[model samples]
Structures are given as structure tokens and as C-alpha cells.
Target: MFRTQQSRSGNDLRFSLLILPGLRRAGMVVRLLMCSVLLLALTALSGKFGEAQAAGSTAGKHRAASSGAKGRHRSVRKKAALPAKARTPARGRRHGRAAAVVAGATAATAAAAVAASPAAPAKAITTNTKPELLPRCGFTEASRRHIFSRGVYVLDEETNTPLFERNADTVAPIASVTKLMTAIVWLDQKSLPMANRLEVTEDDLDNLKFTHSRLNVGASLSRADMLHIALMSSENRAAAAMSRDYPGGRPAFIAAMNARAQALGMPHTHFENATGLSPENVSTPRELAELVKAANRYQLIRNDSLDKQKIINIGRGQLQYINSNRLIRYGQVNATVQKTGFINESGHNMVLRLLVHDRRPVIVTMLGSGTADGSRLDGVRIAKWLNCSLN
Candidate 1:
């Protein structure tokens, strides 16, 4: 019985030793599998975190570029909000099986390192767009009719009745159109001989606006020639020279201009300078229409104003001065009296005394036209309207 018990104890000891090593091997394999699974999970999580961080970084960059200061603060805050572990490299935990686990961890660490790497930055996009256009000068009313000029007046000369009016009472700068009044004042003083030669002086140069003139200082022209160019070509220097050559000079000539305006019942007319270079030379369309009527009565004024071109002596050579009133020069209307004027302050302006059907007379005045063509078109439109009204 004792011998049998000893043999059984030896067998049991040998079996226990064999089974213990096998159980250790199984536990090692299970530990290696657990480590591999944990590493893969960590690697995947790191990759996901990296993707999120890349997305945040790209968005933050866009925001920073879009907004100046506030977006920069938001980007800094987003980077700072990430957990310390997520921001740094993910490392695998050590186990009892050193060599096997180290190999797996090394592979996982390499993969996680690759996964956590920052992605390429996103590109910014831009768009090309066209520039805005300038605002047009005219406006359309409820009646659907557009008037380019700011002020307009049409009058029947025989009946002295307003045929059409648009802001006619608004007083504005008349510009070189003031030359018409200057011509009227000049013709009234018949004693000043038209044959008398007047020399342009430094006083005739436009000091107020510093405007250039072809008729230079020391240039001479007869009173009739001076008057001709002044009305036909809006010759500022010629008008100024005529004023300087008047019986009492420019001051007296200017006074006579105002006096004549008053005599013609133009209560709103005022002449500051003969050249109309001064913005103070102002008159309303209604008053200017009346002035155009008075100017038409003077045969000399009518003839000079209607002339398309006049040859004048300028000391060097004879230069032809063309009429500034395109409506009359182009024969667009039977304009008995016509004048056109412009200055920065006055814009484009025109006055016309038109002979209509049955020897009847019509006076049209346009002020503050946005362009030269605007004034001319205004005249054409009024003439057409008059023709339609008569029919």
C-alpha cells in the first residue's frame, strides 16, 4: 500500500509540472492578444482624434483669415481645449511578456504616430466680381417723361404765356449764357462805335476761374468783331475786353447789364462778371427766356449770335472761332437768338428764341443740363412737343 502511494505521488507531481507550463503558455498567448487588441483600439482612437484635430485646425485657419482679431482668439482656444494625452503621442502599456509585447507596441506606436500626424492645410477660395457703375444724371417721373435738365421753360413770345415749365423759378448759375445779357448791354450803348478797335489786356484774362482763352492779352479786334465772337463763340476774353473798353469800363458795363435785366423785367438776373466765369452770375430759366426775347429784337445781336464762324486777328494769325450754340450752328432749329454756356458750377445751359409756324415766336431755356447733348436733346424734345401741341 505505501509503495503504490509513492508511485501515484510521483505521477501526480510530473503531471502538475507539465500542466503548469502549458497554463503559463496559454496565459501568455491571451496577454499578447489583449495587448494587440488594446493597441489597435488606441491606434484607431488616435487616428480619429487626429482627424478631428485636423478638421478643427483647418476650420480655425479659415475663421482667422476671415475675421481679424476675434477669429484668432477662437483658434487658440480650440487648440488649448484638447486633452494632454490626445495632443501628445500615444504610447502602449508594458506587460509581463516583454519581447513580444515590445514588438507589437512598436508596430502600434508607428501606426499611431502616422495616424496622429497633422494633415495638409485646406486651400482658401476667392471669387471675382465686377465693379459698380456710376449713377445716371436724369430721373423718370410718374408721368414716365424724363427731363435731363434741372430747369426748363418754354414761352410763347406773342402772348407772353408759359407753354411748358419745369423748375423754371429755380435760380442757378447762367455761365457763358450771361454773354447774351452782356451783348444786350453792349448794343444798348450805341455810342460805343462797333468799328472802334479794342485791345485785350491783362484785365480781360479770367482771374476768377483761371480759364484759358485763344484771344490773348495784347490781341486786338474791332468792337463788332469782339461782339460777334462773344455771342457766337462765347469768347470770354472778348466779352471781358469789351467791358474794359466800355464808356465807364467793366464796373459800369456790369452795372448796365443789371440795369438792362431790370428793364426787361428779369427780377432774378444778376451779373457778377462779364465773362460769366463767376458762379455768382445767376438767373432762372423763366427770367433767361425773357432775356432771350429781348436779345432777339436787336438785329446786330441776332446776326452776330447766329453766325456759325467768324475769323478774328490774334496778332499771330487769323483763327476762326466757331459758334458755341450747336442748335443754331447745326441748323437744328430756326433759332433767331441762341446761347450755350457751361462752368463746373453751372453745368450745361442754353437759351433759344425759336420762330415757329405763322411767324410766331417761342423761347426755350434749359439750365443745369448734365451734358451738352442733354441740353440739345431737351431743345429738340420741346420743339417736337410744340409741333405736336400745334397739330
Candidate 2:
């Protein structure tokens, strides 16, 4: 069908030429035929040239490879080629150099990244054995919710080593735990007549507001009565009275407390107030245990601390104050002395010295208890756990 159409076109052109106004009809026909032949030759030549160009470009980009060809020392053919529409740029002749620069840049980046990272040990050190976790201490299976603190601790009356421990060095307020220390220092410093006519004054009542004590104003009380109320009931006024009665008043009392803590080797402990009102008044469970041990050395602190019940006749007459620390009657161990402390900032804090199964005195301190019962339970739990596990 295509050949038929071409034949028809040629016939029309030939017929048109035959009728054209010209020097002669035959001559005009011959001239038209010659012109058509020349056009055909030119079209064929253009097609061949285009095909050769396309083939060359598809072979590869031209590179100036050194070689001997023909008569010239270096034969330069139109070796580098491009598509008919796209011409090659001279700058791209240095492709190898450009690639080298990029390779170097990548290597440098890798090296910099490696250098910036933490270095592994030079030796190919390796271990395949299972690691040893510390032996479980203090109530190992006890639920964490039942614990009074965020840390782990172990109490053994026989072995001074912690049966268990976790972050035991952190310092925190001792709360009424401060009173035991106060009583210890008092017993040591004041040799004034045991009945030195100690009186609870206005300042003592005023200080009770911050201490959570129930001591009323205008209550006349003796030194011994104040000590019992303070140690057993955690009365702030009683503690304050003791602090103010020191040789140099409260500041002197605080200095003595700090001095005594340092002397006791409680390196991280500090006392800003005698009644433990300030959250800044802090110590470690480890240090508190030390303080409890030291406190037990004194007769008054040990006796009052061990008592589970007490009845004092203050100015109010026939006043009764129950022992705040309940571990004394827990029956886990015979507690020689114990004190309990609680505040929003300190939670429930308690310390106790007890006669253990082997007759060794074990002292324990626990902090951040969940409830009022927490401190007492912590002491009994530790004691019980120690007997079962450590022994």
C-alpha cells in the first residue's frame, strides 16, 4: 500500500511538470527528474551520517588513550562521542581526577567518624561466662511496694557487712531519728545535776509548730521528763528544750551534733537542727546505723529507745506518751532502744539497736517508708531476714 501511494505521488508530479509553462515540456520533465534524483541522494546521505553518529555515541564517552595507529605517533580519532543533540564539554576529560577527589573525601569522612567515636579496648578481650550478681540482701523476695525505701539494704546483727545494699550512700533527713543523737550528745555534755530543774519555756512551745509535736504551751517539765517525751513520743518541744539548754544554746548544740557526727566517722551526715525539722538535716542509712550504734553506748538513749511504752507526769500531770517505734514488741528480736521519725520530706525513718539471736547487737536504719507502719516493719523485717539469711 505504501509503494502504491509513492507511485501515485510521483505520477502526479510528473503530470504537473508536463503541463507547466517552460522553455520545452520534455526539457522541463528531464530537469524535474534530475532535481528529484539529487534530493533522494542527499536524503540517503543524511540518514547514513545520522546512523553512524548514533552508533559511535552509544559505544562510549571519548577518552585520550595513548596508542600508536596509522602513521602518527598518537592516533586521534573522533573517539569521544555524544548524542547528535548533546555536545561533550572539555572539562569532563579529567574524569579520573574527579573520581579520585570524591574517593578521598569519602575515606576522610569515614576516618573522622571513627576517630570521634569511643575507642574499644586495643586487645580483643572477650568473656563468655555468666557474670555474678551480688548475693541478695535484706528481704530478697519481699515485694518492693512493701519496702519503706527506694533502695536496698541488709541488716545483720552478727556481720557488720551489709547483707544487701543499693545506693546506701545517699543522704536524707533523719526526722525524729535526730532525737536519738540529741539525747546521746546531751548525756555526754551535760553533767549539771541530773535534776537541774529543767523547765519547758515559751521558746520551746513556739518551736513545736514545725516539729509535729503535741507538747502544749505553759507545760512545766523536768529534764528527764523532756528526754522521755522527746525520745519516746518524738516530742519536738522536748528536743528543743534539750538543744537550747546546751552550753552555747541551739547553735552550740548544732555544732556539737556536727562535731559528734564527724568524730563518729559518719562522714556524709549533717545536722542543721536538733529536732530534725529541716529536710536539710540528713544522713545515710549506713551513717544512721553508725549513729544508732554510738547512741546505744549511752544509758539514757539505750533505755528510752528500747522501751515500747512510757508514762510521764508532765506539768499536765499523769501525762502518757506511747513509744512511737513499735519494733520493740515485734518479737523478731529484743530491741534495746529504738526511735521512729516521720515527715513529708523524710517519709518514715527509724533506727534500732537489738539483741540478736547470737547476742550480738545489730543496729538498723531505714528511710522513705510508705506509711507510719513502714519504719517498724522495716526494722523487724530486716532483723528477721538477717537471722534467716545471714545466720
TM-scores of all predicted structures: 0.62, 0.60
Per-residue alpha-carbon lDDT of candidate 1 for residues 69-112, written as tens digits (9 for 90 to 100): 56556666789774332112234433434555666688799889
Q: Where does candidate 1 clash, by residue pair?
A: none
Model 1 stretches with alpha carbons more than 4 Å out? 1-144
Best candidate, lDDT: 1
Report the C-alpha displacement of residue 283, candidate 2, in angstroms.
Answer: 0.6
Candidate 2 residue pairs that clash: 62-80, 305-337, 305-338, 306-336, 306-337
Each candidate's lDDT (Cα)? 0.80, 0.69
What TM-score, to 2 decimals, does candidate 2 have?
A: 0.60
lDDT, candidate 2, 171-259, per-residue tens: 77778789878888888885645565576777775443354456666676778778877887788888888898888898998999999
